[model samples]
Target chain A: MRVLAFLDGTLADPDAAHIRVDDLGLLRGDGVFETILVADKNPRELRPHLDRLARSAAMLELPAPDLEGFERAARKVIDSWIGGRELALKLVYTRGIDGDPAGVPTAFAMGLEIDEKVQRARTEGVAAVLLERGFGPDVAERAPWLLLGAKTVSYAVNMAALREAGRRGAQDVIFTAADGSVLEGPTSTVVVAKGRTLYTPPSTIGILPGTTQYALFRGAEKAGWTIKVEPIPAAELTTADAVILASSVRLVTRVHTLDGVALPDSAALHRELVAAYESEY
Target chain B: MRVLAFLDGTLADPDAAHIRVDDLGLLRGDGVFETILVADKNPRELRPHLDRLARSAAMLELPAPDLEGFERAARKVIDSWIGGRELALKLVYTRGIDGDPAGVPTAFAMGLEIDEKVQRARTEGVAAVLLERGFGPDVAERAPWLLLGAKTVSYAVNMAALREAGRRGAQDVIFTAADGSVLEGPTSTVVVAKGRTLYTPPSTIGILPGTTQYALFRGAEKAGWTIKVEPIPAAELTTADAVILASSVRLVTRVHTLDGVALPDSAALHRELVAAYESEY
Candidate 1:
């Protein structure tokens, strides 16, 4: 197990690195974060992740993240990478410690080894359960304070839903809104393919605008694949030619089964997405 | 600002203490926590808080917290308190660092000084805005994975709601359901008075059963005041004789106005409730 964290994932000791006990990120999960895939000792799609981080911070009313500083830190970690061939670099920007007169925001870059199980899912695919995310797009639209579009760390419910999935003998979870619209995976974007067109939920539906999904779509556009951002009803998933999950770390994971029912196979489409993510990078 | 944290708040350095970078508590906000009021160098209503912590942990499917250990730690912190006359002791139990073979759970007890501003709200009262919590009781009833009734550290939404309150020029917020039912405050419980009875949203509505509210009600019952746990429609708040918020730290906070409109004053009832909390302790 290799561990390192710092301004650039450099000097901080993995065993000793710690944030303030009073840090809002620790106490209140009051923060935003991004996980970027570092391939070839370089951060891929760096700018997009930073942009999303800034957007997330803005949504939380947090001071704009120091993106330039984060960029430097992320690059340093990648340059000195010691873990694996591909690294999952995480950047966390928190609302600082409690009662600080300075109001300094706490930010750090850390590297994590992609879990073997998560990586294996990219090829072997995964079984998932559909769980209620509790709100529809309409509610999210009217309730900005819910911070649905932002990738804040308040993910207890997401984790719980995943646990519930596991209890049902599934490995992953796809969240659905009350209106019966397919939302997103616990930590990934949900994408469905039928024919040459790939469909995903729009940002208006309060799903995180996935960085990897965007990259794939941009790449697929040139590869003659049509992309559509629309509301996908829960029933649509069952009939879709392929159901896939995309994230920064796990680039392309096909959902083989949902609620114990087999989904249509799309190994060819899945491989294309993986290639697209890599080729675009 | 005074600080101390340890098995008994005796040894750990406040400035140096920190959790790992990938702590699930920090990474995923996957944890349960309780904030208890400490008076006279003792943790008040300690057992109730511990019980809630266990319940919350069970809901998250984390390992049951070692309640006996937590009790001893709480006592230690209280024994060596060096803060104000009253302290807000927070107990946090997290589902350890990621990928640990042992799957060790992280637990800590920290003592924080009662903020002067929060203390003032107890008497001066607070103004609040009603914000959409985005889901109704029915959704929560069906979705245990939502973790609605548990007080997990995943408080990003709660903190965001408070910021929204500040933006609306209010000091606090009352979260309402999609069905227009009054839910709870960002960090407190909702209690409204009408004549001799106090009505709060029932536990069925998925609100954290408030410890302070419970103590107050128990005391109120002895004082010949009736308490009812029921759904409060948004409109009912306007006609209520008194609106109040209760929490472990900020006990007996009168909500004098809702959405900038004045709620009927019930100073005598407010005073009585305050006395109830104090007398019960």
Candidate 2:
């Protein structure tokens, strides 16, 4: 079952839920979105997602989104769901009608069942290819206009990266900067683990700070795991104890290989990391 | 008056026409779009726009869009416009509903009045700033998956760049490559005129091929003007006889200043370039 609600907590007919044709979200992709995972029909870490949504809006210079309204809409939909143990809740906010000086923003929340591919990746793991993302470490500070930290709706490049992965007979991509620094995945954050320590790239590298990754790192830290926020070179990933990509919906998935070469995988480490992330809820 | 039409040439109420909520167009910005200028109620260079649309879809590895259907839809909308001297006709194609393997693409056409800002930019000219766009000249070939040459709906960066221009007290932007090569404008193509010669950066530099700029050069070349398709250093734009930005709807607009330094205001040259562009019709 699927449920759709506008920011005001008003439910619309799923088939008839429509936005304006001139909505800048579709026309120019001038918007931000968050994909939240609902466990047992309850949205996990909704507050953090809302906070990140506000952060993304600030980065885009779009008017501040109505966070309370979004939270209400999200709760309204998830509470109304009569099926599924898990749901992928998406919150979307777009610069409204093109020339409306009122600066009203179009926002909505929808609850959808988690796609089977996400489940497969979580259980079966993923093979990824390292690809150049065409940015340097200085981009975040020097070019704030690029909206690197903000999860804007302009994800055509990210989608293309996934398709490239598919073409290479892999299921995922790990982006590398021009200086060979390991970046995040197309739709996930990179995590490298060695023994009891977990390592991740800092948000200063012009990448979106993954909410799930932060939770995982925090939980692991409390469990006596060293969390190092440092620059990771591309060459270092293949030699790590375990390489994982984390996202809100996908949780955590270990990479089985990089560019056709096998990398270390630890199912035990995966379970432990997943538990750490789950403890946040 | 604004008019909206589907791929089958069926007109719909502007307020009532709605797409599926799961359309990848809105969710991930997984789509391609074109904005064509309707001159005297006729879409200018309709064929080239359709060709470019197809090329963009191919670049994104999306299913080939129905060109004939798009043409019919565009004509249907433009033909129904009964207000204003000119309208901007937009054709949009997206990778339909998310999980459906059938892969039916979402496509539509719309007719809108030219924005007042575009008109002001054309007649009064614009102040432009040079911004680093974070891509090199070899990006198109090296990373085709980046969608650099495609006019995809993922234009958040372009929108942000325009906002950056506003913040910098400029009206437009000329994106420079990481290697200091002059690229195209965010929404327009850069054209430099020196006496009887016109120079435009080649499409090889990871920029969209501007239909209006091509027509301008072709028309000017037939009229005994030198047309050079070569790499333009970012510094050369400031020294040219005149700097202009050209796009389908905006047509041609001279750059009045570079970083607040007043540029040559050549009314005669602007008129000549406009005439050369109009000659294409």
Candidate 3:
């Protein structure tokens, strides 16, 4: 893999690039990140991703990220790539080394060839399990410090939930809130379709608003599909005509089965959504 | 200040110690860690911390950590230090660099001088704010994947909570469950005293079991103090004789006021608890 890392405005070999062990981002997961998809050396939806990154950094009280610096670095990495393969560009900003007087933020931009697993999940749908997120839907509103919408790097619980799904022979998981309301996937957003209406759990419920989902919703709205953001009960998922997990890297991935039960046929819907997503970029 | 970092099995300068930018520990916060306090070159409650680390690693489904390697590295770091100042020894194990064929784990032990702020918080009681933890007490039992009992490196929320407390002119925070039940502190276990009984919220409520609090409870039990684990209501705290946040590093920190409401006097109890904690080591 021809990987590249832009460390603090300087591009370095990704294999050798490292952050201090005491970086709060590594030690305490006190950081924020965004993964952007680059096709044929062109990054998609860079501005929105950068904006979200800034929002996440603000929520953590870390210094504001250098957006222009990140943009330049991303372009440099993408331009340096030799292959035509899709690249996964990751931008990270972490609270710097502990106890430092400067308290500088460690920023890095990394590029790598898209993973085969993610490609596979996109092409051949996914078997998903419903997992409890352990937080009530209203918690985010009541406790902003919980950082429900910030997309912070503290994803240990999210990773563990995904692993738990894998152990049960599932490829993905949809986290339901403590009140049994459908939340989102570990690394993606959940969207369900019923006839011409599309439903996604509201971001007000403390879920990270999905960039790809927003793009898809915009395109879908132009295509005469009604978009509704509201609480989705777990039981309503089985009745939907189609269900999909949306994210920047994965784009639109169909959920073939949820919790051992096969979902209704939605191959045509998946195709439309994929087309809408690709058209946005 | 002199610092030491054990990279895998090799001890190196903490200033230069770094992990790959692609490490999942940093990217996804997919790792487990333990922070042990070293007083006068001795790591207090080392065994319990190690046991908890293993349990945390298991929760993350990371590979089994090399406990003996960690122990040797810790001893080496402590031995290398010449100063009598207290040290904070942090051990971390993360699923290795992304796309590695071997899937090796990145393990490191880092040593640093304890912060003066932590020392002051222990000697003088801290003003604390009560924050909502966003989960009902029973969520941990219902959703094990939340990894509530495991002290994973994903502490962004905890760090945010502390920052929020600081913004409110407080030094610490006590997390309350969604149902208005007292949980634990952002970095410490909540221990309340009324007469001869010591009350701490049970570990079953999804809080990390406090090793220092456990040690204190054992000594207190032997000294004729009754120990009880139950869900403590937030209102009950104001009436308590004394309340303290107990952790490995902080030891015992009294909560002088919670949410601007002054707690009852407990200086005599604080003295006794401090003596009990020191004697345990």
lDDT of 3 by residue, B204-256 (tens): 99999998899889888877899999999988999999998999899888999
lDDT of each: 0.86, 0.89, 0.87
lDDT of 2 at B83: 82
Badly placed stretches (over 4 Å) of model 3 are A7-9, B7-9
Across B113-183, the per-residue lDDT of candidate 1 in tens digits comes to: 88888877988899999999988788777989999999999999999999899988899999998899999
Give i-RMS (Å) per prediction: 1.1, 1.3, 1.0
Instruction: Name the weakest run of 10 consecutive residues (lDDT summed) in model 3 chain B.
Output: B1-10
Candidate 2 fnat reads 0.70
* Per-residue lDDT of model 1, residues A131-247, tens digit only: 988887787778899999999988898899888988999999999988999999989999898999999999888889999889888888888899999999999988998898888
**What TM-score does prediction 3 earn?**
0.97
**What lDDT score goes with residue B45 in model 3?**
90
**What is the per-residue lDDT of model 2 for residues B82-164, given as tens digits with 9 covering 90 to 100?**
98989999999999878877999988999988879999988989999999888778777898888888999999999999999
Model 2, A104-152: lDDT tens per residue? 8888999888878999999889999998988887777788888888999
Selected candidate, larger lDDT, 1 vs 2: 2
Candidate 2: DockQ? 0.74
